[model samples]
Target chain A: MIKQERAVRTREALIRAAAESFDQDGFTVASLTRISSRAGVSSGALHFHFASKAALADAVEEAAVVVLRALTHDAGRPGSSRLQHLVDATHRLAEALRDDVVLRAGFELSGEAARVPRTDLRVSWRDRVERQARRCEENGELREDVTVGRVVSAVVAATVGFEVLGVRNRAWLAPGTIAEFWRLLLPTLASDAVVARIRPEGTLRSAG
Target chain B: MIKQERAVRTREALIRAAAESFDQDGFTVASLTRISSRAGVSSGALHFHFASKAALADAVEEAAVVVLRALTHDAGRPGSSRLQHLVDATHRLAEALRDDVVLRAGFELSGEAARVPRTDLRVSWRDRVERQARRCEENGELREDVTVGRVVSAVVAATVGFEVLGVRNRAWLAPGTIAEFWRLLLPTLASDAVVARIRPEGTLRSAG
Candidate 1:
């Protein structure tokens, strides 16, 4: 039992280290030896946990999906309007992206052509956002003129934009930046009654 | 004069080759030998034209700036409303990005962290957009409630997002995609009187 627990901890540490390396150097150049060193593990130990750099990246991507899936599930809690759920989810994602290297690396690695990711994060995110938008349409929360495809494209593009821009400027990840986007977009997207009920700041209190 | 003309053509070919390499392989991994070969030039000739890879990247960035500067200048024609010019420029940029490898590479190399870019394309683009938004404010073209800063951030973010997304999917660069974004945004942004006059097609005929 003790050995199993220790192995699990080492694996987690190595995953975190690999995510940092991949995020900084990109998938093509990130070295497994360096990742192990960053994690304070021997090369043999890294090999034991992950057979190759691609496997390590897959693990990192899986971990990121876990974090993202939780955020999506939490945001989609029953009783909230679908549009509000999407608003909250985007804010949460931006906050996670600002604070978490794993998520950032997941996004970066998925975009890289040198490696085939186990799952494409952008497609996953677009599908999730599209699902919620469809739900909003079914609930009649969307404005009569707004199409699900249009909202999906705008929201996906803006969120992906924030991720790319945040690479250079951390300010792009700020809650206010996302809030401002929602504030501008919501009036045009949601029905009049729904617009009044939704808060651009999301249900969560702003740390800023 | 014959030798000088040949030298200029060689230099142009080298720039095109380097842009292709940088756009496909990224700045860190792209090599001078490969670029020279792609340009059908000798290593000695490449060195004579460019001191180093960094110098080559700088030249590509400068050429992109020339293309971008023309787009901005054309969009800001004196007779048009500042907002209209801004819209037209973004559409032109999307088309240029779709057709021009040097401009695409300029953006990619600037985003790369492995090397410092002579010019940061994102910053340059944001500044140009901000200036136009301010001009729109001066001309009283923006809706009374819209702030210049908000418009700048959204426009920059969305445009940057399109560039990044276009890396993987050329469809993102289509005129209709950009047109849809403006179609959704312009009504809310322009005063009711101006909204009717502004075409989301961006005053340019779609090649499609």
Candidate 2:
């Protein structure tokens, strides 16, 4: 059991180091030697954890997905509309992006032309957002004039923009920015009666 | 005059070749030899035109800026509101990204950490968008409840998102996608009296 725990810790360290390398140097230029050195591990141990650079990137993407799933899992609290869930989720995502390097690196790698990874973090996130928007429509929370396609496109593009821009400027993902986006849309997006109830800044439990 | 025109042609070819290389291989892995060959020029000729890869990238960026300026310069039609000009410019920019490889590559290189160019296309674009949003406010076209900062952030981020995504999928920058975004925002974005006059699809003179 002790040996297994040690192996897990070593894997985590390698993954973290790889994430840092990929983030700073980009996937095309990141060096495995530097990653192992940053992780404080021997070449043999690094290879044991991840055979190839692509494998290491895959591990990073998977780990990021785990973090994403955790944050999005609890978004649908009881008594909250799906639209509110989505609004809160955007804020939570921006916060995670601001704080978590692994998630950010995973997203960066997915967009890169260097190597084709098995997972696409942006596509995955976009799918989740679409699902929630559809739910809002089904629940009659969406305004009649707004098509699901428009809502999905705008929300995905804007949030993806925040993620891409956040790579250079964290302020793009600030709560105020995301809140203001919802504030501009909520009036036209939500049914007239539902607009008052939806909080652009997010609900108490979900925002945190 | 004949010699000067040929020199200009050679320079243009080299810039186009470099833009294509940078777009496909990214700024880091792009090869100078490949670019010169693609331009149908000798290595000696390429060196005569550009001292280094960074210099070539700067040329490409400058060329792109010229294209961007031309598209935006005619946006403010005499009969149109500032809001309409901003709307039209987004469409024109999207069309440019879709059809103009040099413009697209300039944007890609600006965001790259591989080299630091004197000009930043994304920053330049954000500043331009901010200026248009401010103009809308000055003309009383923007709703009193809508802050200029919110418009700037959302518009810049979303357009950047479209550009980034369009690198992989042309559909992201499709007129429909951009038009839908404005559709969702225009009602809430324009002041009550000004909402009816703004064209989300862009004016005929500008959309093309």
Candidate 3:
């Protein structure tokens, strides 16, 4: 148990270090050497934990997925209303995407993984998102008109798109653009009643 | 005049070669040496044209920007209706993004470049789109209710969102999805007469 705990700690440290390096220097320039050095581990130790830079990136991405899943799960915990839960989760995810470098870097990593089929991160991430969509459907949060698969795909695509665009165009959309995108988009997918109440004037407007 | 002509040709060749290399192997895996070789030039010649990989990437992205601008310009040429021109330009851009590896790769390069401060590709792209939106508004193709800036932003965002998503999740979305997205989206922004005839089964349906 102690050894396992230590291993988990080391893994977390590696992910955090890698996220910082990737955000600062980009995917190509962020070397494994820098990640390991920041994590205070030997190069061999990194290799033992992750076979290569691609492997390390996969681990980091999976860890971020786990974090995001945990957040959605927490939002849906027993006491919250379904609509409130979704709204809250949307806010949380958007905020986390903005504030957490790991979540942001995971997006860039996923893009790279998509281009390189050898990286397993894309497949695993896809499966996890699919499972989450199923869970959302089960909870009756999703609209009957929506397919779980389509919803999952749209959610992933929109989230990634908004985050990436925000990061890339930070000057024009310097503050609160990600937040605004979710604010606009979430209601469109939500039940009409929820959609009505989420306006700038705080009054329920007619449906779009 | 002779030296200037040769210099222009070398510059164009270098940009084209670099774009092809980056598209085939991604930015990280593509080598400048290989690009120079593929351009049928020496390392010294490539250096004289572009001092570094980043410099080469910038040229490639600029070329793509020029292509998109030209596309928009052609759509807005004399004798074309403004709204029709905007819609047509969007269709052309979508098709080019789907078919041209160089354009798509340029998108990726611009995305990475934008993350770092001082890269203004995002702003320039948005400005170009906004100009088209203004033309549409003047032509009475769009609703007076929607602001040109807002419409342009949404249109640009959705286009980028759809393409990036399509590329990442290429399997779920069929080859025709890009056309489908625009078909669905264009009418949403168009006047009621255009909106009325845009159903899936209508003769005005988008071509794949």
Candidate 4:
């Protein structure tokens, strides 16, 4: 049992190291040998865990999916307004993109043409945003005229833009930046009654 | 004069070749020799035109700037609503990003961290957008409550987002897509009087 736990820990460490290299150097230029060295593991050990660089990237992407899925799940918990849930989820996601190399690398790698990821992070994000927006529409939180497609486009584009811009300037990832975006958009998207009920900063107290 | 013209042609070919290579292979992996061969020029000729890969990237960025500045200029022409000019310019810029490899490579190269650029394309773009938004405010095209900074943020972030997304999906760069964005945003940004007068497809007749 102890040996198994150690192996799992080593695998996690290697994935983190690979993510760091991919995020800093980009997928095309980053090397497996360097990733192993950064993880303080031998090349043979890295090979044992991941047969190739693509496989290692897939593992990193999977780890990111796990983190993002949890954020989405928590934001969608029952009894909360779906629009509020989406607002909270987007804020949490911007925070993750800011603080977590694995999530950031996952997004960057998915965009790189040199490799095909097991899952496309952007597609998944669009799907999630669409799904949440549909729920908001069903809940009557949306204005009578706002379409789901337009909301998805605006949310997805702006959030993805923040990710790219934050690559150079971190201010793009600040909570206030996203809050301001929501404040500007919410009035346009929701009925006045719903808009008043929703907080751009989000109602959930937890920072996560 | 004949010799000078030949030299100019050779230099232009080399710049186009370098932009193509950088766009396809990215800056780190693209080779000067390969770029010269693609241009049908000798290695010595390429060296005469550009001292190094970074120099070539600068030339491409300068070319992109020329195109963008022209678009901005046409949009800001007097007798047109400044807001309409901003909309038309952004659409034209997106079209250039889709159709012009040199311009696209210029943006990608500017984002690369391996080398510092002579000019940052993103900074230039943001400055131009801010300047245009200020013009719109002065012309009384904007609603009283909408600050220039907010307009700048919305315009910069969404346009940058479309560029990044369009790298994978050309649909993001389509005229209809940007028109939709402006359609949604204009109603909130302009007073009812201005909104009624503006067309999301823009009022400008120029193709530039």
- Per lDDT, the best of the predicted structures is 2
TM-score of chain A of each: 0.95, 0.94, 0.66, 0.95
Pull out the clashing pairs in model 2.
none
Q: Residue by residue across B51-137, what tens digits does model 3's lDDT show? A: 888788878878887777776673346655565555555566656676776666677665662234233444555677788778777
lDDT of 4 by residue, B95-120 (tens): 88999998888887766646666877
Q: lDDT per model, in order? A: 0.86, 0.87, 0.61, 0.83
- lDDT string for model 1 (B1-208, tens) is 9999999999999999999999888877899999999999999999999999999999999988888888887435565778878888889999999999999898887677566678888788888999889998988899888888888877888888888888888888888888878877787788878878777778778533
Best by DockQ: 2
**Clashing residue pairs, backbone N/CA/C < 3 A, model 3:** A196-A204
List, residue by residue over A58-101, the lDDT tens digit for candidate 4.
Answer: 99999998888877774355666899899988888888999999
Give per-model CA RMSD.
Answer: 1.7, 2.0, 5.3, 2.4
TM-score, candidate 1, is 0.95
Of 1 and 4, the candidate ranking higher by TM-score = 1
User: How many steric clashes does model 2 contain?
Assistant: 0
Model 3 / residue B97 / CA error / Å: 1.9
Candidate 4 segments exceeding 4 Å error: A74-79, A205-208, B74-79, B204-208
In order of appearance, the predictions have TM-scores of 0.95, 0.95, 0.75, 0.93
